[model samples]
Target chain A: MKEKLYRAGDIFSRSVGLILFFILWEAAPRLGWVRSTYLAPPSRVFGALWLLALRGELARHALISLRRVMLGLLVSVAVGVVLGLFIGYFRRIDRILDLLFQAFRQMSAFALFPVFILLFGLGELSKTIIIFWASLWPVLLNTSSGVKNVDPVLIRSAKSMGASKAFIFINIIIPAAAPEIFTGIRLGGSYCVMAVVAAEMIGASSGLGYLVLYSEETFNVPEMYGGIVGLAILGIGLNWILHRAEKYFTSWKEV
Target chain B: MAKIQARGVNREFQIRNTLGRKERLKVLEGFDLDINEGEFLSLLGPSGCGKSTFLSILAGLDKYDGGDILVDGRQLQERSFSRGIVFQSYALLPWRTVIKNLEVGLEIRHIPKHERRRTARQYLELVGLAAFENQYPHQLSGGMKQRIAIARVLAYQPDLLLMDEPFAALDAQTRENLQIELLRIWETDKKTIVFVTHSIDEAILMSDRVAFMSARPGHIKEIIEIDLPRPRTEDIRNSAEFAKIRKNLWGMLQDEVLKVQSYGGYL
Candidate 1:
């Protein structure tokens, strides 16, 4: 009972700042401290959100953005993990590709957007490729380092037991490097959200990013804030799902 | 015939110096010994004396530049399921539960799942940790982890066991307890074991013979026969014979220890 009360108190304390900020936001417009047209109040923002939901427009755009992020993330994970494993396992491969990969990593994904547009055109494919490009580096680099840093003692122990090379690779190396791989995946996940939103803002007809940009252009400040809120929710939800997945897979790790 | 015969074993390491020049560092030279079948031998020496290196070679986890290691009258080629090794760090798969860790070797050998589970449980019981079969290695104490390590190797039923300072990291009391437990286990199975350690007391209490090793490049300084009676206990540590053996072994090791210390400790 005491612990439960303590937890309740903890939650209450943590949310106090958010509650105060919202109250201040609501009071500012009412008190005319700021023009309601220039900065929509929290009430107006939430009201705009409810209107968009009722029209089903919010869901439509959110689903499109969600789909793009998922596609890009999936493709990046597949290619990155496979390539990273090869690079990490073979010193020769690493030596051959290190300089090229390092150069590519140094270039900004946004700076290459025009090149992608020129090559693939301003379509779903280009947006996805942008997200994939942004996210792939983290997964690839982290996985390679993770595989490279696997405890030699573990490998030696497995070898001493007469474990075949394939068996060692599948059982010892993969599981041992999983924590790091998950870290890479989590970082890649956030990068996916960032890159997808930016890509949509730059060139796309639908998505939370496009909605935010379109609303702002039409002077619908309240709906723009609503789209911003929606994007925040999407980012948080994606991160939470990835966090849960990481916790599930790496449950063996000591707190 | 001896179970393992190391005839003039030699090993060297090439390391880059400050000037980026390759320099050969000899770790073992003319290291020779004969380990009789089912005999418990302790390779005892100071740190960096290459006793562990020799044991690694014996386990076929390492290669020697010049040597013939005969196992069962055949030249040792590579690692086989016939020899299992336990390490100082307990090297348990952190992701695997205790029982699953025990089953790793069995899995590698392609044993059936049911048989692997049974053997794992049996070894878990033998180590007196039946209740901890479901617990991960990180959850266990150092002593418990080492016990699990021992059980993991024993689960495979290897013909030979190679232990490199398996109990060195535990507290003194825990070390003594494990030493007694290990002896008890050895008494029942009598598997040929090459135990590596730097402790004089551990060497005398656990082995049929203590192979004293010199500093790098290491070779057998002397092979002292430990004629202590079987089924030894912690009380054996307090015995007069144990003290005599300890003193004698320490006297032999004193020069090597000082020699290493003079050279600015471990190389």
Candidate 2:
């Protein structure tokens, strides 16, 4: 009963903090302490959001952003896992590709945007490629590191039990490296969304980033605020969803 | 036929310092030993004694510069599906639940999924972890993780079991409990076991014969037989007979242990 009360008290305090934050935000605008032109009030942003929702523009933009993020992330995951397994398991391959991987990873995805644009044009291809590039390194590096860090004792144990190389890879290496790989996937997902937004902002016809830029240029301050709010919500939502998935996958792990 | 025989086993490791000075570290030097089928032998020595190196050679995970290991009348070059090892770390796959971890060896052998599940369940029950089959290794205590490891090896039905200080990482209480559990498993499995440990008490408790080794190019110094009765309980540690044998083994190891420490090595 004491434990129950403590937990309830903890949760209640957190809820109070959230309520206080909103109260402060609401007061700042009501008192006109901040310029309304530069920082549109949260109330005004919500009103613009409601208008976008009624016109269905919000859904359309969110769907476009979601599709791009998923496509780029899926490709990154596939290529990263395969390449990582190869580099992680084989000493020769790891040695051969180590420098190349390191150099490529050091180069930022944003810096390579121009190169991608030249290759794939300013269509969805270039935008998707930027996301793919940003997402790939984390997934690949994490997977390889995970595979490399598998316990030598486990390898010895598997060999003693007469498991073949293929068997050990499937049975031991993959499962042992799973937690790290999932961590890589989460990092990659975040990068994928961030990169897609940047790609859309730089050169794209439709996306939340493009919508934000278009509203800012047209001097639709409320619409711009609405776009920024939407992007923030999307990023938080994606992160939360992936975190839930990670939690589900690693449920067997002790907290 | 002898369960295992190592004739003139020599293992060498090459090391290069930062100055590019290359040197040879001979871990095992012309080591030789033999074990009968169904024997429980403990290789007892201090750390850096190469007892584990020797065991690794016997398990066919490491290649010797010379000599060969024969298991059941067949000379082997590398590990086959005939031996199973329990490492000191327990080495349970953290991502898998206890049952899934136990099923790894079976899964590797391409046993049907349902059969693997049944076999894993049986071994999990044997280890007294049937209720916690779905629990991950991180959720378990040290002793429980080691038990899952033992079950995983047993699931493979290997004729020869190689244990490299399997309980050395646990606390004293947990170690003693695991030693008792190990003996029980050995009795039920009826497979030949070659266990490596530094504890004289542990060597005497679990083995049919204790092979004491001297460190620094490790060599077997003596083999003492334990004529104690089966199904050993914790009370054995307090028994007169057990004390007598423990003293005898400790006497033989005293000089070696001193020799090991004087040479700047650990137990």
Candidate 3:
């Protein structure tokens, strides 16, 4: 019971700063310390969110952004994990492609926006490709390193049992590398959300990013803040889901 | 006929020196020994003596640049289910539960699930870890983990057991307990075992013969037979005969240890 109370106190203490920030935000505009026109108070922003929800605009934009992120993340995971396994397991393949991958990984997805738009014509495909490009490197690199670093003793132990190569790869190497691979996937997930928003901001007519940009351009500051709030919620929700998945998959690991 | 025979086995490692020049470091040279079926043998040596390397080669987990290791009249080229190895580190799969870890070898052999479970449970009982069947490796103590390693190997029913310092990482009490337990298990089946360790007392206590090794390009310098009666007990460590063998073995091992220390060969 004391432990429970202590945990409650801990959470309250942690939230103190956030509560103070919200109060100040609400107070600053009403007190005229900041212009209400430029900076919407928390109350006004939340009112704008309710209005957007009532009109179904919030859900529409969020769904579009979510779809793009999911699609891009899925594709990146497929390509990254499959290629990473091959590269990690085969020294020859790693030797041939590692330098090129390292070079490409250094280049940002946004910097390649012009090239993507030029080829894919600024549609859903380009937006998705941007997210995929942004997210691929973390998954690829982490997975390869994870696979490469699987304990040699484990492999030797398996081999001593007359385990075939396929059995060892599937049973030993993949499971051994799973924790690092999950880390990559989580990092890739955040990248997907960030890239999709940026991509939408750059060229799309829809999505939370476009909503925020379009509202700002129209001087709908409250709605813009609402869009920012919506994006934050989306990002947090995606992260929570990935966190739960990571926990489920790596439950065997010591906490 | 010998269960396993090694003839002039040679292994070399190409490692870079401090100056970044590649140099051939000889790990084992002209390593020859014959392990009789159902006999217990210990390869006792100092660190960097390549006894573990020779064990790995015998397990077929590593290759030798020269010479032959014949098992049952066939040349050992790769790992076979007939030869099981227990590593010092107790290389149990952390992702697997105790029961599942024991099932690994059987799984490789494509044994049926029911049979695998039965065999795994049987071995787990033998190692006195049946209660930990659901526990993962990381949750177990070092001694418990080694017991599980031995049980895992035994679950597969290998004809030859190759152990590389299996109890080296445990505490003295745990080590002694396991040594007694291992002998008990060995006595039941009498599987041909080639154990490796650097500890003189452990060597004298456990094996029928101790293959005392020399360091820096490791090879068996002498094979001393342990004539102490079985079933051996913990009190044997203090017995006059045990001390006599231990003293004789340590006298031979001291020179190799000094040679290695002087050469800075602890790799």
Candidate 4:
């Protein structure tokens, strides 16, 4: 019974926190902390979200963003997993490519927006490539380290049992390195979202990022607030999906 | 005839110190030994005395700087599967169930799938792990995982078994129990075995002969024969013969242990 009360109290506290945040934000404009004409209140933002949904604009924009994210993330995981395996397995490859990758990784994702815009034009092609490039490094680097650092004792045991090199890599190194590789994928997925949003905000005919930029430029303050809120929800939802995936894949890990 | 023999073997590693000075570190020098068919020989030494280094060379996992090691009078070669080694760590594949882990060697040899499963099951039963065959390594105890490691080795059916302190990572009670099980397996297989270990009591319990070794630039200091009868029990460990053998090995090893400790990572 005490355990049940503890769980109930925890849930109530979290709900209270959420309600208090909304109340403060709503009260700020009513109390004239800032011009209501410029920032808009929570009530006004909800109204704008409802209107947009009624017209189907929100769904169209969300679908565009979601499709772009799916394509970019799929290509990145495949390429990243393959490239990481190669770099981890062979020292010669790692030596030649590591410095170049490190240099490119240090360059900011937003900094590449202008370059990608020119290379592929301000189209879906440009946005997709930007997202792919932004997400690649974290996944590749982490996966490489994970595979390279597998226990040598495990490798020795495998070899002594008459395992060939290919068998050891598949049955030993790949599984041992899986947890770290999953971590890389999670990080890469989030970066892909951030890059796609930045690309859409800069220039795009459609997407959730464009919705926010377009509303703000035209002085639709409530719509702008609603779009930002939608983006936060989207980010949180994607992160939740990735967290579940990592948990599922690494179920064999001790901790 | 002896199943495995080493003659005038040497091993050296080129290493860089903290100050970036390159040095040729000799791990084993002029090491010679032989283990008769169906005999258990423990290469006992202090840490850094090259027992593990010697075992790696014998397993064909690492090459020596000089001289030759032979199994049934054949030279060590790359891709040779004549020797099976068990490592100090459990080293069981985390993703695989016990049965699959045991099947790894047969897969490498491209054995038929049905045959691989059949062979793995046989060995799993041998290690008393048939009930836990579907569980992953993480789900098992340390001793259970080591038993899976043994099952994997036995599945390969190599004629010479090389173990590098295989029970070192386990708790004391588990180590004692596994030592008995290992002797039982040795009795059944009648394979030549070369075991490396640092524990004097363990060496006394399991080996037919114990080769005491010296520290860095390692070489055999003495090889003391154990004349204990078969079907050894915990009772044998408290016997006068065990005490005498332990004392002799300890005396030979005392100076080497101090030398290694004094250097404290210098070597």
Candidate 5:
């Protein structure tokens, strides 16, 4: 009985806002304060969500959306890490390319969707490329800065003790820059999800973004709300997972 | 033969002036010193007097525009394991545990894992930090962190130990405690130590000889040998001889301190 009460209290404290929001959502439409057609009631949205799951369509869309983000993010992570290492470690490369990278970063990734579609041919390729483009800067920017900002005193101390360049890079530079890199990765992770939604809306036949668009067009306000809810849930879940990864990797950090 | 020798060593840094114009600021000039093996020598000076800069050049971390520095008859070029430094800020890798931090130089040199662990453990004990092995740098106090820095450098077993105001960040009590501990370890290790500091008392208490440095474009003005008895303890600070030496050094530093004020303000 004590354990049950403790669990109840725990759940209540964590979900108080969520519970209240859902309560308000249910009451508003039902009491005719808000039109159900424009903003579906909580029960209707949940019911539409249940129907999507029952038909396995939600699972398929979530998987497809997640897969696109994963592919794009993987490419970004690989490219960002390699390019970041080069840009950070090689003074000449950084000096030459810093301006160019900064100038190109001024252009929004979505602004180049038409360009990507033309170059890659509008299928999964263009969508993934757009997501990759959207997310690359955070990782690249964070990583290079992380590498650059490693305490010069630490490097000097290491060097004074005859630490080799290769040895220092592996043992010092990489680990020192990790916290910043992980932060970039988390930021990039969020960017990936947001970018996939935009890319999916522009050209995709499937995915959660398309589902939301289709539901809106068909006047299925409940399903549209369900799609929005799914995106929110996906974003939260991704953030939580990435946060756990960051904690595990940066276990030594005081923060 | 001197373990380390600097003859008319000069350094000039190209820095932007207040006018946003590039100017050559001479940080070190006509600097001469002879450091004997296994002796604790402190460079006592005013702030921005280039004592740390001189130490850096000796450690091969910075380039000297002119003049000569020889370590065991060989000229300095780049960093080597023969010289290890303990920075004012401790410079511990926050990502590594206390024991692992000590293993940095050992790991870099490709020492076997078992031996590295043993060496780190031994130095950890030397610094009286064996209990805190698993803890990260941020977990430790300022004094504790500096102790770890000392242990880390000692673990590497450099022949020349260069220190830049290693205890400056610590409180009075902690600084005194580390100073005593440092001497005890120095007795055992017997590395040629070139310690740079602004504190007159710290220079007297910890060093076998204190080299008083002049104002910016710094060079040794005088080297005072402390004939105080060995195994210096807390009681030595109260000794008449210690007070005399302190007074003498303070008089030397006072002029340099005034010079620093004339330029702008003291560090």
Candidate 6:
């Protein structure tokens, strides 16, 4: 079998491809290949972002959006991990909840906005709920699976050494599941940002998402593009930090 | 004296049918064996012959229904720290460094941190892998990983090491080299090693005795004691005596292999 042409997360350095993409992005609007009205020039979008930052609008909106994302992430991770570990460790509980949870997990979390708004009301609670709901499943599901699929041989090996069940759970099971658990948390972090932004765009009075939607409604194309660029930056920044955390925590695992 | 004994051990697997009926798959039926202390014994057989199942039962990692297994004349009921296992897949925790892995048993024993490190260092040097102490399992090749696995089992200070095809995944050259390393280690420690392997040459080269087994309600066919001289090296592979034993095992093992072929048709 032929090997894959490229590996995921191996695109960080020596990137001829990403450079070409940026160059094309800059050239398209300037060359009139793409209309500036439909697709604002990168320079203008950046300038707009810079002006907003200078005027403090970007900082205010970005901070508001970031706060929501962090709160949602914190809540979801705490609850989701506890729930996931319970579901994963208890076979009976896993069997009962896996099907129902998977069904809810199957439905797009954003589609629950109406239900969230109805239950929690159109406030910060509802916005946070959207993100919390979006981020919960990945952590919960990944953790459960991670716990369930730990190599039986490893467990057996540990058991043969006379390791207690509690010792095995802490040392063997947690370390074994760390890689997958981090994967869930990282995905949840991304979902938190995405869900919050979407929620803000729909109803929040202020935030990066609202800025983008408000700019678009007011026909401020550069500001709209700048807000989106802000989102991309936020997403990239969150991923990069999570990458560092994964490195620190899973130093024992293969790169 | 017998170091380990299994008297009419039986293990069965219950499988659920489509009609919700349970069927019993007898893996080992009335199997019996005796292993002496400080001797290298190889459980030689084809795949799924319950050799590993028996080894696991002996190691107290699995339960058997119909027999009494005595370890050092004590009835075996649960995993004892005195018995260690080395798996074919190496089974080293990928998250742990070589030294950390070697220290696992000591950790379970609740040995002081400094003491465990000193012991881990000794065993790491014993396996000639001291330079790779900080390396994780993923960083090591199959041969290196298996060496680390041996080092860990040694560090655990188990008198009886249950090795399940410890070198089966390595290349032939690495396998041969590890076999030599194992002999050298065994010479120094003289721990009783129960090795499981499907390879006839591996069995003859490493064992003081080979207990051949047959599948489909697996049981030991016969125990053949290898009368080959000690500190046996690869040069023995060229000798007439080595050839004779290999031929003997191959001839007996061929029938079992053929049984597997008529039923399963693959190695």
DockQ each candidate and list the results. Answer: 0.86, 0.62, 0.84, 0.58, 0.86, 0.64
Q: Candidate 1: where is the Cα deviation over 4 Å?
A: A1-4, B18-20, B262-266
TM-scores, all models, native as reference: 0.97, 0.91, 0.97, 0.93, 0.96, 0.89
Per-residue C-alpha lDDT of model 6 across residues A227-248, encoded as one tens digit per residue: 9989988888888888899889
Writing each residue's lDDT as its tens digit, candidate 5 over A155-221 gives: 8888888888887898788999999999988999999999898888987899999999999999999
Candidate 2 off by > 4 Å: A1-32, B16-20, B229-241, B262-267
Q: Tens digit of lDDT per residue, candidate 3, span A1-255?
A: 999999999999999999999999999999999999999999999999999999998999999999999999999999999989888999788888889999999999989999999999988899999999999999999899899999999999999999999999999999999999989999999999889878999878999999999999999999999999898898889989998998998899998
Model 5: residues with Cα > 4 Å off, grouped in runs? A1-11, B263-267
lDDT of 5: 0.90
* Candidate 4 residue lDDT tens string, B1-267: 667778889999999977799988989899888778878899988788788988887776788989878778777765667678888787777877789988887877788999999999999898898999888888899999888888888897887788888999999999889999988888886787888999999998998888888887888878889899987887899899889988888887887878887888544
lDDT string for model 1 (A1-255, tens) is 999999999999999999999999888888999998878999999999999999999999999999999999999999999999889899789988888888887778888899999999999889999999988998998888889999999999999999999999999999988999989988999889988878989878999999999999999999999999898898889989999999999999999
Per-residue alpha-carbon lDDT of model 2 for A1-255, expressed as tens digits? 999999999999989987787677667766888766766767877899899999999999988988999999999999999989879999788888888998988889999999998999888888889999999999999999889998887787777777788888987888778888889989998898788778889877788888899998988877898888788788788889888987887776666
lDDT of 4 by residue, A95-141 (tens): 99999999988988789888988888888888888889888898898
Compare the candidates by TM-score and give the number of the best one: 3
- After TM-score superposition, the amount by which residue A222's alpha carbon in candidate 1 deviates from its true location, in angstroms, is 0.5
Query: Ten consecutive residues with minimal summed lDDT in candidate 1 chain A?
Result: A101-110
On the 0 to 100 scale, the lDDT of residue B262 in model 5 is: 86
Off by over 4 Å in 6: A1-44, A217-221, A252-255, B16-22, B260-267
TM-score rank order: 3, 1, 5, 4, 2, 6
- Alpha carbon lDDT of residue A181, candidate 2? 87
* Off by more than 4 A, model 4: A1-16, B113-115, B258-266
User: How much is the lDDT of residue B9 in candidate 4?
Assistant: 92
List per-candidate RMSD values in Å. Answer: 1.6, 3.0, 1.5, 2.4, 1.9, 4.7
True contacts kept of 5: 0.92
